[model samples]
Target chain A: MRSKIGLLVVFTIIFIIPTLNYAFAAGDEPGEYLDRRVVIWNLFFRMMVVAFTIGAVVSGTMVWLVWRFRESNPNAKPTKYEETGEW
Target chain B: MSEHGNWAEWVYIGVVCALLVWVGAEAWNVERLVEHVPADAEVIKVTGQQWFWSFEHEDGTKEIGELHVEKGKAYKFEVTSKDVIHSFNIHDYVVLIDAVPGRINIVWFVPDEVGEHEIQCREYCGLLHYNMRAKLYVEEST
Candidate 1:
């Protein structure tokens, strides 16, 4: 449980830190193309950040759930539940 | 299992809130950029056809493939299209305005520095949409 929490925090910081930096580092100065490019790049960057954040959160949740409630019946024998009929 | 359900709900809410905050902050920043247009600039009417751009400056100077503007002056670009909808995007300046027929979309910026900026058609109009490009030349005031 502690390891899972640590992993979640590490992943969160790794993904969120860059997004925070990018969000704040967007152009604040006035220049010819520099500021404009920064703005455009910021848009694309933010989109990426959002995607990464969502992915991290979803995957993290899945990992947490798997770790928390995985199959504890280690001694149970495998049942023959194969599908043999073909269409 | 039911004990963890509340925790899951909290995590879901937290994620949603974070996303909302992120989107809101970005929207505010972009809105600020869009609202501010410098004064003392000329107006240029840019019309996009199938594969080219037509530029008309305030001084009645017309050109194709190249646009010229004086440095340090704000230039208002009135963008429209002749055929299908196209987006006039200046990648370096981060200016993008959709060019639609019968409607004028306006974007303005001051070219404080003198250089050549590349303009591209952001919307896919046809097979040769990638070939649509124009140049913006910012020259020192004569």
Candidate 2:
């Protein structure tokens, strides 16, 4: 369980590091084209950050649920099973 | 372990709230992104035909297949189509405005450098649409 948590944290960091760098590293110069481009690109970058944040949260939740309900846990109950095909 | 799971859920909730706030801020700031035509901007009439573009200056100077403008000045292009719908696009300037028949659409841009830029029809109008293009020359101000 500790190893699983460690791996999940590492993966989350890997996903988040570059996003933070991109968020802060926007070197928009002063020009007619660049000024207009920066406004659009800033919107795109912010949207990307929101998307990545949502992805990280959802994926982290999935990992946590899996770890919490693993077979080795004595107090965890069995998950409901559904048949794949209809007879 | 149950406590840890609860904490993780709280973190996820916080992240979602932050995302919502960011979206709201962006929505409220939409006006800053809108580009308005200046009152003193130079007006140039542009007509997009089947396979070529025509430009007319305020002084009645007409140009076909090429447009000339002075650098460091904003130009408002009033565009319309002669036959079918054609899109006026300049990749270097990132200007894309649709030209529809019987309707006029205006777009403005300022060229800061002196060079020749390619003008293209983004929408497919006819068989010769691939050959529909023009040149925009930004000359140094006298």
Candidate 3:
């Protein structure tokens, strides 16, 4: 849909476009690192950020799903395995 | 494609694709940054022997167990080994490259700090592998 495409474009412009420069940002920063060390450190920091974010997202999702789909939750629907009692 | 609805599937695919693209781009950037040697970089030959590191500067100045370089200058190291495999690592500058027999590996770094840093072999070579080490002195450019 046009609305979906528009939203994607807007999201990319606001978020993705700004970060595109990071790919070429392996240069002198205001610190002890100014060369290859800076590039490697940036990579490590970025990877850790992504790792921690993904870890939190997965853990939070698992906790919410477990609580929402517990057997004690009356609103939880019975899975086909539960109905068949075979799994 | 579990029949997990339409919009959810598309959004999931888009997010995964975006993440992959970003990771790939970052990887390529790092590769370029590490591999692209500067034209003005000073070449230094780093030789890894049984249990010692030797350096040969561009002016043919040789130093054993000690490498003297200037601060704020880019240096390209042509690393190789005389015996078994070894790893040339200068942890202060995050420079790590393999030293394989019959093969030369290239790595470069620009030292911003003018001080003495420890260099060591990260790979096990021989009985004295633990003692295989050197010192890197980054002197201020005169």
Candidate 4:
């Protein structure tokens, strides 16, 4: 479930959002070319979304990892690599 | 780790890397397209003084606190500074470029809307930096 959610985050941030941004840009009616208002505005918004998305995902992952693997976690299980120092 | 799990991890990494590479290429292309100035773009010389912005048109007309441009026409601003480093910004049009001493920086934009906009120096130059502002008039073409 965790990995699935992480993958979903990655896919949305890396793929879906940018594709939507382009779709909106491509739909513009022909009149002005290279309007900085649109270009810079879109770029700023897309980057802001990507940055916040990535930051949230990474922070969530770190929090989850800490909560699941901390020394106080009762459900923590030692894997083969952790037990015998070999994988 | 199990062999299948190891393979899955590797494949996942490979897919992510491929997607990242694709995104990077797309961003590079878009940046180039945005910064590319066409041959017919009108050039306007922009000088960044210590406390004000100045513009010079091709016809030798000059303005200190105001710039008039035609709507729908692409304009290329060749920016430079006289005393210190400054940043030229037309916030309404999102045209921002560094005005460095001894070097000319370039930024271009097409004014789609005909109206009054704001232009300001984004860098700290002197005591009067806060008052360094101008009006951008995008007049309709005759």
Give the best candidate by TM-score: 3
TM-score for chain B of all predictions? 0.86, 0.82, 0.87, 0.86
Best by lDDT: 3
Order of the predicted models by lDDT, top scorer first: 3, 4, 2, 1
Identify the runs in model 2 with alpha carbons over 4 angstroms from their true place: A1-35, A52-78, A82-87, B1-33
lDDT of 4 by residue, B50-76 (tens): 799999998899999999999989888
Runs of candidate 3 with Cα error greater than 4 angstroms are A1-34, A70-80, B1-10
| Backbone atom clashes (below 3 Å) for every candidate | 1, 0, 0, 0
Best-performing candidate as measured by DockQ: 3
- Across all models, the iRMS values in order are 6.6, 9.0, 7.2, 7.3
Candidate 1 stretches with Cα past 4 Å from truth are A1-34, A39-87, B1-4
Give fnat of each prediction, in order: 0.16, 0.02, 0.36, 0.34
Error of 2 at B61 (Å): 1.4
Cα lDDT, model 3, residue B67 = 94
Candidate 1 lDDT over A1-87, as tens digits, reads 999999999988999888788766655543232245556577878788878977998899998777765656455443344253332
Query: Residue B11, candidate 2: how far off, in angstroms?
Result: 9.9
Q: Is candidate 2 or candidate 4 better by lDDT?
A: 4
lDDT of 1 by residue, B1-142 (tens): 1123487679889988998887787776776575455455478999999999999988798999899888867778999999999999887776789999999998877677799999899999998799999999989999
DockQ of each: 0.11, 0.06, 0.23, 0.18
lDDT of 2 by residue, B29-111 (tens): 53233355656778999999999999999999999999999988878899999999999998888778999999999877778
